[model samples]
Target: MKYNEFLPITLEEMKARGWERADFIVITGDAYIDHPSFGAAVISRTLESAGYKVGIISQPNWRNVGDFKKLGKPKYGFLITAGNIDSMVNHYTVSKRRREKDYYSPGGKMGLRPDRASIVYCNMVKQAYKGVPIIIGGIEASLRRFAHYDYWSDKVRRSILFDSEADLLVFGMGEHQILEIAESLKNGLDIQYMHHIAGTCYKSDTKENLYHFIELPSYETIATDKIAYARAFKIQYEEQDAVRGKVLVQPHGNSYIVQNPPAMPLSEVELDRIYSLPYARKVHPIYEKDGGVPAIEEVKHSIISSRGCFGSCSFCALTFHQGRVIQSRSHTSILEEAEKIVKSEDFKGYIHDVGGPTANFRNIACEKQKKEGTCKNKQCLYPHPCRNLNVDHGEYLDLLRKLRKIKGVKKVFVRSGLRYDYIISDPKDTFLKELCEHHISGQLKVAPEHISPKVLDLMGKPRREVYDKFVDKYYKINQSLGKEQYLVPYLMSSHPGSDLKAAVEMAEYLRDIRYYPEQVQDFYPTPGTLSTCMFYTGLDPRNMKPVYVPKDRDEKAMQRALLQFKNPKNYELVKKALILAGRKDLIGFGPKALIKPLGKERQNIREVKYSNKKPATKNRNSSKNTKKR
Candidate 1:
């Protein structure tokens, strides 16, 4: 159909669509934006395409069951998500302060939805309609499918399946698994039987049929024991692949939560079809009065040409959420979308981003990855590029070249990350030359994370020398192309292995490069990532090796300050950190100093400058002269 034919949201809209009842009532924590970037929109639209009637309840009021019953009971079940991001992460800052604004809400308003949105919404639905299937999905449910450490709660939380009392949990990208669930329900299969579907998690009273699967430590064991928690996380991490992955079972109270192997990556044609579906590509017009959803502006002009990331950064949740297998759309598919975008009334000459999880990853890591899933233990680009890595950007480069030639498109920018180490490994320098010559607006953002080898090793990032090598190559290519582009390296502080000494080392490296990052991320330990496990358990889950975790609040702030030590506000914290790390030498006015020491003279001057009134030196001198007279 057309873009205006969005799925039914209100009873009147349902009547207009000639539907008396929806097959699924989808509740979300975010305002309804019918764009592909919104998970609820995509899942609903995909179901609609399959002749299943779907209605949306966006940002439902969760204090009562009123908003949950707005769409009425569905014929089959209810699908719930905590929007694009986990609700807790969206509502609270890493420091546990409630944020004042929400990008997913209309007019960017806060408190549009409650915390732990998925669980709250599910409970509301459960209270409203007993015996109806309640399915939880999206970032919140997916990451918490097993017992995971909740940063906000500061304790291990049980599987969301148990907390929400939902029948099933759909983890990862749910295109395939969702369709299967819908089909099974439509064919008269019970929700319990839907457990066999890939990319789904279900609770069972008994593990009678569970075969050839690894069992994680029970919830009681993990919640009370950090080592057991770390061990459980490693087993879950390894069994996330589609090919080699097996069912993973974890005990929760008296029952068990079982996660089926991940769904297979979509083929080019399948991915193309999913993107080409008639998406309204905008926030629902109903939200116009309160101002449109702010989140839409970021992706309205961008194209998700691919999915999944093989970069495998330890701190990233993509591996757990989307898997590591890179699945990309055909160049033809992307060009067609570009043509549509150019014809839009709002088409500015720019295509904001032309990539997905990792922009340059347009194909699987290696040819063998397609037949056998990504290696469970070994990383593709970390430590070093795998010997068998097929590093060819030919397809991606050609895609960019064609998009550039589009009539109304002025620029095709790779706003998403470009894995630099991957680029340097390529035999041809054509992608690098073109990237610097055309794609870059001025500065390209790359993630080096940290300069310390110890920290980088824990982060699953390339060595410090590897990033330096790439930086050198990037500038060289830019110089050859007569471009004055800069590299904005993304840095993170307070990661698990980052001690005070490591933080100081990072500060020294920044001083040498003469680069002061305007923004630095203090590593946030969200659920379902290797790094988060390390942060919580103080051990590398992969090897159960003890890792030094900087858990002290003051120390984390110090680490953050060290990254931006050039800032006057952070000078004191940097100095404190330098002294603690035994790098007191970094607190001077020398070339090697990270911060200027707050000596008595400097402190007095700073106090005077900060005060509204000037120092009393003039008054004292006048009084002294008067006394002399």
Candidate 2:
């Protein structure tokens, strides 16, 4: 079979391919790169493989209708996305400042796409082609498919299905939903009547068609009442599963947004076929003159061995989007992809990465999850590992071993975020041993996020002690393997439940380790995260208990500064943070001081340090040592 070189992007290309119109036109906020890593490419290709002619319109000019009308009109419908990353996230910094560069754009150019791109592009399509079906998905639409807190807007907004005025919203990985939607459209089914498809959301005037679906709080109620909003998020979080997941519905005035349950996780053979799909595997030649798309470089030589993550960090929307179960490509499929990478001119005898969201998770967390679904009440690795969690890493190790053995492949690195909790949960040391010896170049990236127990629990991360144990094991493995390596722990600040005291505690821990974080991640409350729910409502959705959120600009900055206290620029912020948290003792030039007392106060400053000590404010989570399982 002749494979697709690149889906037509222009009228000339369309004519050259002998196509008058495409079956589907994929509108993306990112520059067109026909690689599987880009969602638009995968969705478009998935349609193309099913005998549908799919076209790509990437980073179109939203101010006018010409770019939207470039493909004339799709024979079936339009598939729109805000690219791999959310548009708002792509546009703004955590401090709500406009970003100077967009990785998905050509030459890392800024402002190629508008803010709230999914909404903007959908409206543009409607204006360009009247009455054509527009289906929105990708991370932006998937996470905001329900009434969600929009940080950029600083308010709870209605689902994208309504906001975009699109006919359908495909949440999660849309390969399944896209295929079904394409086939239905080809069979002459109306987009409105195509509401029964799983992993898709549609707006309806009545709830009569939905069966066994839970009704969440109305948009009006959630927008006004924080408790109701928290409650709504709680229900949404618990019900996001493929197996045993029920349909969910939320109301907005006269209509209901009905979300069908997520599609079943792809099987091993099915996932393998998707990665093996004919992809151009490079930025389109159109983008080459503009220094190419910056996003493709990271993924060019990499192999996505799996999809879906069960790590379920509170700040992560993977739980609400990809769901908890793991779906991986087969070993044969991965090796085949690796062999192709080896043949490339720029290979350099190195396989850059071989993993998914969480590199180590290659299967379902437990036997029960395979049939009954992830427990709505329990987590696989938070609080503590479940008694039934399957912790074997044998299969993943073997896959790595085979990739290492592949000809012309010198190194196979696991660069994705590896769950440290999952690592220590295993009784065997072989995975860690092999990891240090064969996988990493030097430093492995892990996300402990914070060392404060209260913040860790609220972030749905494992306890501080879990990170400690993992660190010890990591170093020990490196020492035994006769390799010199380091650990780069990804930490966050200003998350809910992280008060000044917690931030100070984190700073002190970093001091103890003699490691200072060069870059601090200030929590940005994006849509559909449990932590974002808490950030917006000031209450943990799990229990409706108040959480002290660091929302003030000064407090957020101070928290971020405390993490990098050793930086000379953060001296004043760290000193102020110490005084506010009643940790004035940490301000002097003593052995444990976070910062030296300013100016002449350095003269035996211990005597005057207590003068500025203010009583520490109330900590809502200080007494709550354990996660609420």
Clash counts per candidate, in order, are 0, 0
TM-score of 1: 0.94
Clashing pairs in 2: none
What local lDDT does model 2 show for residue 379?
A: 85
Off by over 4 Å in 2: 1-4, 604-629
| Model 1 root-mean-square deviation | 5.2
Off by over 4 Å in 1: 1-4, 601-629
- TM for candidate 2 is 0.95
- Give the per-residue lDDT of model 1 (tens digit) for 176-276: 99899999999999997777899999999888888998899999999999999998999999989999999999998889999999999989988898888
Query: How do the residues 119-158 of candidate 2 rate in per-residue lDDT, one tens digit apiece?
Result: 9999999999888999999999999999998888788899
Model 2 backbone overlap count? 0
**RMSD of every prediction:** 5.2, 8.1
Q: lDDT of each model, Cα atoms only?
A: 0.89, 0.89
